[model samples]
Target chain A: DPQLHEYMKLDKKYRSIGFLSARTGGAPHVMAADEAVKATNTEVVSIEMARDTKGGAGHGATIIFAAEDVSDARRAVEITLEAVEKNFGNVYSSDAGHIELHYTARASMALEKGFNALVGKSFGIIVGAPAAIGLVMADTAVKTANVDVVTYASPNNGTARSNEIIISITGDSGAVKQSLLAAQEVGLSVLSSMGEIPKSGSTPTLI
Target chain B: DPQLHEYMKLDKKYRSIGFLSARTGGAPHVMAADEAVKATNTEVVSIEMARDTKGGAGHGATIIFAAEDVSDARRAVEITLEAVEKNFGNVYSSDAGHIELHYTARASMALEKGFNALVGKSFGIIVGAPAAIGLVMADTAVKTANVDVVTYASPNNGTARSNEIIISITGDSGAVKQSLLAAQEVGLSVLSSMGEIPKSGSTPTLI
Candidate 1:
């Protein structure tokens, strides 16, 4: 029980990065874990899988850990897989199972830092003609994202000409990057006018 | 069960990061989870704490997965915490216990990449005293570090004079900044060579 208590502390202290999948004995073993292991300066601890892929004949679970730093996080994943293979008896053994994992530092870090950056930032999009509406759709995405950017366009002089748009953004560097990327994607979407446009905007941009 | 099965699948996917802690009645609970719960995501099937913490406290249990992905992993942690909270009849209650959860991308990608980036980097040092030994020491550090540039200088003359030593280094450009910093620290250790004179350098030119 004390061991459990310590494990909980280790679990609580480190950050988790991604999920992994494996199969053992025909049963599936799916696990989500952090990038680090819990232990004293020199001790090793095992993290049990939370969601075991069961019923089909699989055994064992994938372990995940969050590294203290980027380098450490990466190392943790490698070590965990090696440990799994050792525990299950073979990397390619059908009875031993499989391991699948993913990295999301950029996405995870951005989400965490981006939300805080989003506080109070505001903006709007302008729409006039149907083509102008497309720009509006694009602008909506910028408004909701962490970056504080706004975009708009002027309608062409002709009766049915498209619009020329301008996008401007302001915020912390990371948030600004996210906003810029989002805006660019949406802007492109509208300019291309893929599929049928939505009502009003008819061609709203996807986030 | 089917709904739980679906939820479990959703939970097993994706990278998830969170923290854990102890709650009332000694139960364990997840403190925070990101993108764990969603309308169409997998539901958490159960929550189990590690029965051991190595030398600390809390419950210990591995998570078996139904599938693996970022979203599924997030859900597993969230649902486990929720279940614990429900059993304890409170949210954020201390009686349950604590376990931080983190989802990493892959096991192999965690440690080796980071380690590889740290070994065999460049180093340098400077000493203000004319101590041949100091220069020798600097050379040793440079070789040990396996770096490209190792430059150091001592005072033009020898007087056992106390002077500030400035050290600078440039090398590999591929080592971790921390490792480079370590090299710098090593250089500092040899800067004055324990006030010993060189064993083979020619006597200083008399001014």
Candidate 2:
């Protein structure tokens, strides 16, 4: 797990979106998110002009927030996004346009670190369960060692068990299909190893 | 606009994710581009178990496709998510174990129509230019009659000196801020206008 500590060292943040409703004559302002707001650095707000006129009743606004810590910000973003969409049916279009910001603190740190990482690096891909030792080491290698790295994971990594982790990667159609197959392999292996499957379930799964 | 006629209808044949790839591989197999696939789609795909470990020489494969399409697919899932952040390095944890196939379609003629129309739709978005009545009617009102429609152009709509429409929706933090504000207020007004802006840009510009 300590190996994973290195991978986790990279600064990460979460984001959220929400819609705020004006109470009759009430002014338009973001609803208080309480501790969650403090935890995440929320920013960028948009009002759903469509919802603001339903029955010509009240005004609605959509807010986009970015937070400092990741898990908190991610939760905030989810809550905001869901709330706005549920309240405004027409809130789904990217046509409305979006604005994203990299705050000074985060931007400065990334610049300081990114350039150093870039200077001495060569291209390479990081494969395995994202939490695996190999991946963490590869991330570390890519960072401090000037190695360009790409990280990936399989369904076998118990990803199906938790919603806490999010993985992002790039691959071709063949690579994607293979990734799906690999995930299947990992999942089956886990099921059998855990004795959740009957001996009959062991039809000798295919590669 | 006739090019976009087919997409207006609900079609089932256009349901494969690996459509092109399947053809290229000479494999007739097609995976349903169901809700689950859409939910799981990402800009990056990683297949850790299928890694070709030749001592890190071509150890991994990275393929970059059109970022716009990738962004579009991702937006479908995230819906109204705001401030999306992808660090230079982060693992794309997978959930193949929990994969589910909730929707399916083998093939159909209707899908081909929809695909063609969808392509045309993009073209419409580009040249319609908000001032074109035919464009606005075709876009905001025609295809999406059930939804509220709104459109606007800057330079006070008539101050521009050029024949070619220059529509600018900036993505930079500052520009994004201004554009979003304009979208919200103008959108609300349009909904209230109730077809006040003529279906045709026949009102000659004073500019």
Candidate 3:
């Protein structure tokens, strides 16, 4: 019951979670996070290494925090940023290299639980094309294998490339491999049909 | 009480909300979404135009769906993808042009309510960085203005060029503009300090 109570607390806690993720250049993520927690009354939720193959951002660090309220959350984020800035030096922000801060309200439930459920499973990823095709590919992959859909991103949100759709799935290794192969078949078919085209128009030439 | 009840329904609905987003070529976003919805048993939550400034993805389309269950969601996604593939012949998928599929589980709270609460405000965005300085800049921006951070992205996540840190803040126009100016000052200082360095190791040479 205590564990159950604690698990239920995740929902309420997630609702108020204020998140600020910063990209740090060369700073050890653990060190940066430790400094942040030491400076503020916030909890570190996750720290992800930068391995953005699509944007070629290379090795960087991402840190997330859970705070008491919106204001407190912001304060935590601010503290973390300041700590990172003090520890490291060069820092920038842009559409590509970004710092995003927000409260997910209830969105934290998916982040907290969905991620736990999906981890340790093989992953199948398909990137590129409009959303329509991406959806089909994801659907096919799920149907082909006993995989769970983790997330599907559309460019409507400024976070993603407008001309791309990214879908990730997780399952057993065999299922994941099968899903990837199935999705690739669809992707290849789309690619082969496209042939080649000029760059100046709306029709994206298959890369 | 009714409003609270309705809001609670959103959490349940969000859990079941099967989302599918697609990036289209030259096709009109509205038309594509309409067609996808007409052909599927899902509800259209949002449709976004392709305005990817970073990747030069050009005018594209993104559509979201709320489905009955995971199976239904996948089916709807599949139908939409098929429709898009039928309409747009030259589709591609790569790091830059991607297709993503995922289920947020509890993360939908952020998508549903957090975004609504944050939207319609002026935005301040900063891109390019060394990460260390970026965090400081974001902290400064938030501290300087009565603004809330929408999102902070790290170059570690692939959407950004290496060595760049991007931050976005929102509030009143005046607050947003002030935040941008504050962050800019910090960025300029970092840029000035970095000057030029050898490319052999971690010290980045300004391009």
Write one digit per residue (lDDT tens) for candidate 2, span B100-183.
000112222111121111211111111111221111222222222222112222112211211111121212233333333333
Candidate 3 residue-wise lDDT, B116-143, digit = tens: 2233334444443334455556666777
**Selected candidate, larger TM-score, 2 vs 3:** 3
User: Can you tell me which runs of candidate 1 are displaced by over 4 Å?
Assistant: A1-46, A49-54, A82-207, B1-207
lDDT (C-alpha) at residue A108 in model 3: 24
Residue B156 local lDDT, model 3: 33
Per-residue CA lDDT of model 1 for B1-207, tens digit only, reads 456547545443423333334422222232111123322243333334432333121223333323235556555555656554333321110111111111112111111121111123332222211122223333343444444332222221111111111123444443323333443344333432334322211121110
Candidate 3, residues A1-207: lDDT per residue as tens digits? 122113223434543444433322322233345544555666666554433323322234455566666666567666655555443321212223211111111222223332232333354445434445556666677789887766666655422333345565666767766776676567545544555421211221111
Tens-digit lDDT string for candidate 1 (A1-207): 122123223454444332232322111111112212321111122222211122211122323344445555556555545544332221111222221111122222111121211223322222222344335534564675665543333333311112223233445555554554454444444534544432211121212
lDDT of 2 at B10: 16
Question: Model 2 misses residue B89 by how many Å?
Answer: 42
The candidate with the higher lDDT, 1 or 2, is 1
Q: Pick by DockQ: which candidate is best?
A: 3
iRMSD computed for candidate 3: 10.5
On a 0 to 1 TM-score scale, where does candidate 2 land against the true structure? 0.18
Summed backbone clashes in each candidate are 117, 19, 68
Candidate 2, residues A83-169, lDDT tens digits: the string is: 332222211112111111011111111112211112112212222212332233333333333222233333333122111111222
